[model samples]
Target: MKVQAGELLQKINYPSDLKQLKEEDLKQLSQELRQYIIDIVSVNGGHFGASLGVVELTVALHYVLNTPYDQLVWDVGHQAYGHKILTGRRDVFDTNRLFGGISGFPKRSESEYDTFGVGHSSTSISAALGMAVASHYKGETDRQHVAVIGDGSMTAGLAFEALNHAGIENSNLLVILNDNNMAIDPNVGALKEYLTDISTSKHYNRFRDDIAKVLAKISEIGPDAYKLAQKFEKSIKGTLLKRSNFFEALKFRYFGPIDGHDVEHLARVLKDLRDIPGPKLLHCITVKGKGYSLAEKDQTKWHAPGLFDKITGEIKKTVYEKPQPPKYQDVFGHTIIELAEVNPKIMGITPAMPSGSSLNMMMKAMPNRAFDVGIAEQHAVTFSAGLATQGMLPFCNIYSSFMQRAYDQVIHDVAIQNLNVVFCLDRAGIAGADGATHHGAYDLAYMRCIPNMTVSAPMNEEELRNLMYTAQQDNMGPFVIRYPRGNGVMVDWQRPMKAIPVGKGRKVCDGEDVAILSIGTIGNEVVKALNELNAEGYSPAHYDMRFVKPIDEDLLHEVFGKFKKVITVEDGCIQGGMGSAVLEFMADNNYRAQVVRLGIPDTVVEHGEQPELWAECGYNAKSIAQQVRLIGLTRSMQTIAS
Candidate 1:
C-alpha cells in the first residue's frame, strides 16, 4: 500500500528543505510527518509510539538548527524516525528495520545528521557534550550541539554524570529533556517524581518564561547587571519554587516545562536557547504517542507494536493453528511468580524492562518483591546483589545485550562475593529486527569466563522452569540462565518444574557415525537436522549440554569414546561459546576427533528475522543439515581412498 505524505511534509526532503518552511507551517509539517511515520510503520513495522511523540520537536529542531554541521544526538534513537524522514531518508523510510534496510536507531553511518549512533538509553547527553567540547576546541563557536534525551533515559547515572561535567564546561550544548515519562515501560525512580513535581508546579511554570525574559534582558545590558540578574533569578526561583533547582545547582541554565506539542513555541524557544547557551536544558513535556489515540492510552503496548491497522488500531499477530508455545521471557515471567509463591526468598528485578522481559507479571502479582529500576543496568545488578546478601534470592532479569552495561557489577558485587543472585538473561541469541546493537550474542562467552559464575542456557520452556528453580536453591552462587527470544517448540510448555543436576548433559537420541553437542534452544535446530540426516541415511547422535561453565565432561568423554566425528552447535559466538567449550574439553582430555563448530562467526551480524540470521550465520536447521551432508561426503571419500 502506497501512503502519501501530507502536502507540507511531501515538500520536506531534508532539514534544509524544512528550514525553507515558515514557522507557522511547522505544525502542519509535524502532523504530516507523524502520519507518515504511522502509515509506514503500520504497514512495515518498527518502533511506533516514540517517533510519534517527538514529531513537533523533530520539526522544531531541524527548522531552527543548521543540522549536519550542528550536532543532534538522539538518546535511545527510538524517537529518531521523524528526524530520519526529514533528513534525506523519507523515500526509503518504508525499508526501516528490514534485513538489509535502515536501522531502527540513529546510526552515524546512515546520515551526517545522525551525529552519534545510539541503541542503549542515557548516552546522548555525554555524547553531545563531547561533540560540543570538540567544536569549541576547533574554533567552531557558532556550532550548536544538542542531545534530545527522554525522561526515562534521564534516570540513568551516566546522564547525571554528563550533566555534572557539562555544567562546568563553556560549550554550546543544549540538553532537551524529552519528558514523556516513559522508557519502553513507565518511568520509575526519584527522577520521574522530581520532573513531575517541576512540571506540575503552577506558580513555577507560569512565572518561569516571564522571569527568564527579564533575566535575559538584564544579562544582555552589562556585566554588573548579569551578576545582579543571576542573584535576582535565584532568589525569585527559591521563593516561588521552594526548592534548589537540580540542573541550576549543577551550574546549567535550565529552561521550560513547556508544551512540546506546540511546534511554534518550541521553535521559538529553541531559537532563543541557541543564542544564550553555555550548557542549558529545555524540559519539554510531551505525550509519548501524541496523535494516535490507542497508542497514547497504552504507550508501552504501542512502543514497538508490530504491523498494526492505522485506522482501527489493531496490532497484527501471527495466527497459529494449534496452541503455540509462549515466549521465553513470558515463561520466565510466569515461572518466577510460581517459584516465588513457594520460595519466599525469590524476588524479581529488571532495569526498566518490566514489559520487554515480561517481569510485569510478577510486578503485578507481587508488587513489593519485583522492581523496575529505571534504565540503570549497573544499579540493577548491584541492587540484586544487595537483595541476595539479605538471604533473598533475586532473579535480576536483564536483556542479554543490556547485561554488557552491568558486567563490572556482576563480577564485583555478585560473582566476587559469590552472592546467591540468579541472573535471568532474556533475548540471549539474535534478537530479530532490532539489529546488532540489541542482539544477545556474547553472554554465553562472557558469562563463562567469570569465576564462580554458573553460566547455563535452557533448551525449552520446561528446562527454563527447571533452571529458574535450580538457581534459587540453597548456596547456588551467581547463577546465569540465558535464553533466546520468541517461542519454544513445544505446544504444551507448562510442565511441572523439577531440579536438574548441575553440569549434566542429556542425550536426545542415539546414533552411529557422528555426535552433535549443543547448548540452549539452538539444540532444537540440531534436532531438526538429525531427522533430515537420518532420512538421508547419515546417522548422528545428539546431546544437549545445558551448562556452559561446569560442562558435562563425562558426557563429552562418552561421545569421544563412541564416535570419531563431532559437531558442536550454539546460538552464541563461535569464538568463545559452547562450541569453544566442547573443543576445550576435547583438547584437555587428549581425545582425537574431527570437530566442526557451528555458531555465529567473528563478524558483526546485522538485523533480520531469526531464521534469516541463523541461516546467514550457518547454524539454522537447513545449514545444520548441509553441514552433516558435507561431513558424510568427506567420510565416504576417506573410506573409498583407504
Candidate 2:
C-alpha cells in the first residue's frame, strides 16, 4: 500500500496529538504507524522487526501515561522507532540511523521525553530505578517511573540485579516485560522457559479472571465480604501458580502475561497499575514481527531489514562487479571452523551475538565445538576461561563495547591465569552509528593494563586471518585480535595465511621530516593522508603498529632517529589508548622527540557515519594531512627563526 493519502497519521505531528484522539481510533493509528515504519524502513534500511512488534505497546503507553512526565525508558532503544514517530519525530523517520540524522535509539538530547539515553540492553531498569530513587529523594512522589525491557534484555544479569534492588527498596516503579519470545534468534535459558510456561498457562489467567469476577459479584455483601474476597483471591493465586514466583520473590507485585497486541487491554492494565502500590511488573506477550507477513515468517531476516521492495517485501540485492572476501567477522568465523577442524580443543563462543560475530557459521560447521551463551557477556568470558583450563582453545567472540561488562573476567580469569584463549574483539574502534555507548574506544586502555594479555589489531582482512592463525598457534597466554565492523579492504585471499611476528610494527611509507604511526583500521586512512602529503612535496614516514600492548619500541626508536616530530593516529580514546602507549614508550626509553597525539578526545562522540566521525575527530585523510602539514610548517618556521 501506497499509504492512504492524508491519513490521520500524516497529521500526527506529535504524541500529544495521539493522546487527544479517541480510544477507538487507536487501532487505525497502529496500522498507520506500522505502515509508516514499514515504508521508511523499506526505503532506508534499519531495524524493522523490533519497531514493528512494539507498535501497539507504543500506542498504548503514549495514550495511558503522561509521557515526558511519566518516564518511559526503552531498554535497548532499537525498538523505539514507533515511540519516536509519535513523539514529534515523524517527519525525520526517513533519516533513521543515517549520518547526521536522527539516531536509531532513544537520545535524551533529542527529546525531553526520552528520559535516558540507551543503546546497550538491560540498562533501562537500572536507569529507571535511579530516576525513581531521585524522585523519592526529591519528595516528588507524584511522578511515575517505568522501564520497558525486552525478554532478551531480561536475561542479562544487570537487569536482574536492578530488579533485585528495586524489589528490596520498595520504590514505586513499573517494569513492563515485553516478552516477544525472541532476541534476534530464539531466546535461550531457564527464565525464557519459565516466561513461556507462565504466558501459556491457560489455567493461571482463567482462574485469576474467574476469581476476580466472583469477587466483584460479592461486593454487594458489604466491606467484610470484600475483605473475604481479597483473602480468597490471594489463596487461589498462590495455589494455582505455584511455580517459581520470581518477580513476587523479588518483592514486585506481578500482574500478568496479557495480550500485548490488544492496545485497549494494555492501556487498561497500565491505567489500573498506575495507582497500585510498590514495584509492579506487567508481562505483555508480543510477537517479534506482528504485521508484516514476511517479517513474521522470518523475524531474524527482518530484525534489521535492508533496503527492500515494499510491495514484494523482498530485499534489494546488490550485484558485486567483483566478488570480495567475506566480512572480517566471516573470515574469523571460517578461520575458527578450519582451526576447530584440525584441533578438537578449539571452541567458539559468543554472548548472544552469533550473527553479529559470524559465529553462526562455526556453530553450523561444528555444533559441539560452538556455544551461544545468550545475553550474558560476563558469563561468556568466565565460561571461556573455564574451557581454557580444560586445555580447550576457546575463541570468545564479543563486540568491543560489550566486553566492558566482562572486564573483571578478562583480568582475573584469562589474563591472571595466562589462559590460552583468543578473544576476537569485533567492532573494535569507532563503531560508526551505534554512538558513544557502543563505540569500542576504551578496550585498548582497559585490555592493555591486564598482565599476560597480548592485544593486537589487524589492518585488513588478510592480516586479520594471519593474526588469528598466530593467536591460535601461540599457546603462551591470552590473546586478543581486535577488528573493525563492516567490510575490510578487499585483498587477495588466495595466498595462505601466515603467522605475523608478535609485537612487531611495520613501515608502510618512509619519509624524513615527520612520521605518522597508526594502529588498526585507521592505517588505510593514514596511508591516504601520506599520499596527500606526498602531493604537497611533504613525505611523512608511516608505521602500522599492529600491537597495542607491546609498544613496538624498536619501530618507535627507528622513527625517532629518522624524524624529530611524530604523530600517532588511532580510532580510540587518546587518554589511555594507543597514543598514551606510544608517549609512555618514548618517555620510558628516554627517546627525545616531539609527539602529537591524534585520536578521539576524552569525551562522548555521538552517532554518525564512521567517515564523518573520523573527519570530525581529525582522523580522515584530508584532516590528518592538513594537521601534519600545519605541524611541519610550524617546525619549519621555528627552524628558520632559530
Kindly list the per-residue Cα lDDT of model 2 for residues 462-535, writing each as its tens digit: 78888888888847589988998877776575347788888998998788768899999889998888877888
Give the per-residue lDDT digits (tens) of candidate 1, residues 55-111.
Answer: 999999999999989899999999999999999989888889998899888898889
Whole-model lDDT per candidate = 0.91, 0.85
RMSD, one per candidate, in order: 1.2, 2.7
Clashes of 2: 0
Worst 10 residues of 1 by lDDT: 211-220
- Looking at model 1, residue 260 earns an lDDT score of 92
Q: Candidate 1 — which residues are off by over 4 angstroms?
A: 215-220
Q: For model 1, state the Cα shift of residue 170 in Å.
A: 1.1
Error of 2 at 601 (Å): 1.7
Best by lDDT: 1
